[model samples]
Target chain A: MLVCRDLVKSYRNKTAVSGISLDVEPGKIYALLGPNGSGKTTWMKIVAGLVKPTSGTITYNGEPIGANTKRKIAYMPTEPFFYDYMTIANVGKYYQDFFDDFDPNRFEELIKQMDLNMTDKAKSLSSGLAAKLKIAATLARKAELYLLDEPLNGVDIIARDHVITAILEAANENSSIVLSSHLVDELEKIIDNAVFIKDGSMVLCGEAEKIRAERGKSIVDLYKEIYA
Target chain B: MFKLMKYEFRKQLLSKIVILAMVGILELMFIYGVIAEKANTVASAVGFFMVLAFISIMFVSFECAFTYSKDLKTKQSYMLFLTPNSAYGIVGAKVLTTIAQVFLTGVVFGTVIIANILFMAAKYHSVKEVIEVVQQFFKEAMQLDIQMDLIVSLLVYMLVYWILLIVIAMFAITLTYTFLANAKFKELVSIALFFLILWGVQKIAEFILPDLAHITSYIMLGATGIYLVLTALFYLGTAWMLDKKVSV
Candidate 1:
């Protein structure tokens, strides 16, 4: 349940997100499809309250995004964003310290499921393992909305399935999940809706199956048509 | 705010072990210097002051540079900024933690120095005479008027100065790093731009407020307050920029 109106983000003279508007409904997985520099990450960051819009307003469930709204949203960045010296246990403790809804037991369970050691420092993990750890840590929160940026990027094919499964398990009937990734085919089986963005604007957005049925094209075909 | 502060304290605690160990080594050196003073007072005093100067410089530089740079290099800032806490809370926690660490280290070092001086003095003089001698030495070494009120005020001023310097430096470093991280010519451009900005700010401050040297301590304190306010403004600016401008 997030709404963004006339959201525009620019750096100096270059416009990264040019006046895009969108609404996310609860209990649905929305796959944000965009090529590199399409402003998908910008939009997600704005919605997560991590970045302020240059000229726009974002409301979470009606009110403006603030501390209360932020408490309900969990954002996982695409980069490896943790202290080098932080072990999995310390990272868990960090989450526990910051977010009241963070479930330490769930975090440990996720770590075990991912076959990651709690004592291993985050920096020492491989990129795939790091991505898995990031995903697991993010999903351990009892947040109402989850914004994951390129969670599957650089991960092995086998690990991709694990990440997707973790996302599915983390998504509850009352919660909404927005994920951005280039792996469209993998997302096709799980995502309920697709929002296609190109050149900092939304080109296509609707129910995934309905768009295919109405347009006689899959999400991948639609992606090519919009960007190419 | 308390939660944020507690986390900040913990982070600093884990990272400052190396610094604490260095302080420990310096303490041992101070003890050795005092113990060997009878053989060579001038040499011992010179060695002690040299070590003191080295420790102070290293501590200040390390605290200023690495505290913020490590966060950027490690990308730990994402976790920090994305928390539900306010930017003020985050920056304030960092400033407070640095101040706390420095203050605690100063206390420890001061106690060690005092104990060493007292032990050396007791070897040659009566206990009362030793106490007087130690007091006199402190009064002269610190160059203060030796009043309780003056000492308390000086301590407070020093604490504030430490906080303001660390906070301003951190805000500047974090902001510069964030802007530079996504730039085309990252390392060189960032360093050049940072120095340019610093130069520009200094020039502006000088131009706006001339005759700064002639200002009284009270006026200097006021100016320090203004600097702190500016530091807070920079913290907010950095936070806004990161939230809105950052892509990665």
Candidate 2:
């Protein structure tokens, strides 16, 4: 389980994440629903140990997030993160080199399923293809937790389905997944819980179907209601 | 740690190739000029190649200073930081790789120079004449003793200075990224912090050994000891900042 308490992150000019607290239970797919500047990315980066919180502590299974926590957390950033010289094969090798849980055969299978070439350099791929490649590489890791920020941002509708299925296939009962995206309707089907944020604070959070039933609105409607 | 060093070396693949090629070409040119019995041409080539080697080594060290900052700026760093490596591990791997590189470059260049010296002896028939000229030059110009210990100390201090610059530069870079928001201010702080840290290191070293009045050897050895300690401290400080303060 991932737990954060009163997390606050601020820059010299502004605070990106305010006093927000939350828990991520194991064996569930969670949708971190928020628009731009809603602090979703900052929160996820904090959990991934890429960003340090100003005044709060984050723990995974009772230990503070550090190098050990990193091994169990796989993060896929919204931006293309591979070096320019890295090909698909090189990316797989890279993950295999660093991550003990990374399965190259699984990566190869995902690459085939996504119709991506092994010889393609990561920087040269189209945005959609790059997104697919990112998802494929990230999902191939058998980590305890996965935080995928904006996984569906640049993907087309056809590729979006493949991406969602890939994510679903990656999850198991021993792990948890947190996906941050603006594609609400698509995520509503797979997400078990939804956490809504607005302007660096949580507006609402609960089980996906329970919140929908109680509020008498879809996740998309709730997102619009919270942000707009 | 070695795994990280493997990738670090791989990253400098092109630069290494270019450096080695330059060394090989310069050595071959010097040998050819010697065999051709063109004394002035050989002298000019040796002078030019030494200058080239100096510039290239300085350039490589300059590049090493920014290696960590470069990794942080690129999203590719996510691949590295996400691994189970601590910030110390990450920083140590980089520093160690740089040390290994400098050592390798020095060894290769030194080998070529030794080969040339032996070849010169065989061709020109004059080790004593060469020694006389070098002794005269040192006595007249440098006014320093030529001894085995002195030579070793000179080389050791050179390597120590190289490492000090890199570690201090890294500390400055990481500090700038963590503390300052304005890009201009960040650059300014980095530059300012470098000089300040260097001055601080010297002052502290001097302050700790104030009673060593006239012993030049003791002063040199003492300063070198302080510098090694400072390097280790700076390495730890940089790693701490990366772990505790850096946002990415």
Number of the predicted model whose TM-score against the real structure is largest: 2
Summarize candidate 1's per-residue lDDT along A127-157 as a digit string, tens digits. Answer: 8899988998899999999999999988888
DockQ of each: 0.44, 0.72
Candidate 1 docking category?
acceptable
- Interface RMSDs of all predictions? 3.1, 1.2
- Candidate 1 local lDDT, B11-130, one digit each (tens): 666546765576567566655655565446535554765576457644743463465565555557677767887655666666666666666766666776677556767765667787
Ten consecutive residues with minimal summed lDDT in candidate 1 chain A? A45-54
User: Which candidate number maximizes DockQ?
Assistant: 2
**Candidate 2, residues A111-184: lDDT per residue as tens digits?**
99999999999989999999999999999999999999999988988888889899999888999999999888
Candidate 2 residue lDDT tens string, B1-248 = 88888877777767878888887787877888999988787987799789877877776776666567678777877877877899999889989988888777777778877778778877869887766766787799988666777567656766786798899989988888877634675667788899998888778877988853444555667767877888999999999999998887
- Model 1 CA deviation exceeding 4 Å by range: B13-15, B30-66, B69-74, B121-126, B136-151, B170-248
Each prediction's whole-model lDDT (CA):
0.75, 0.86
Clash total of candidate 1: 1
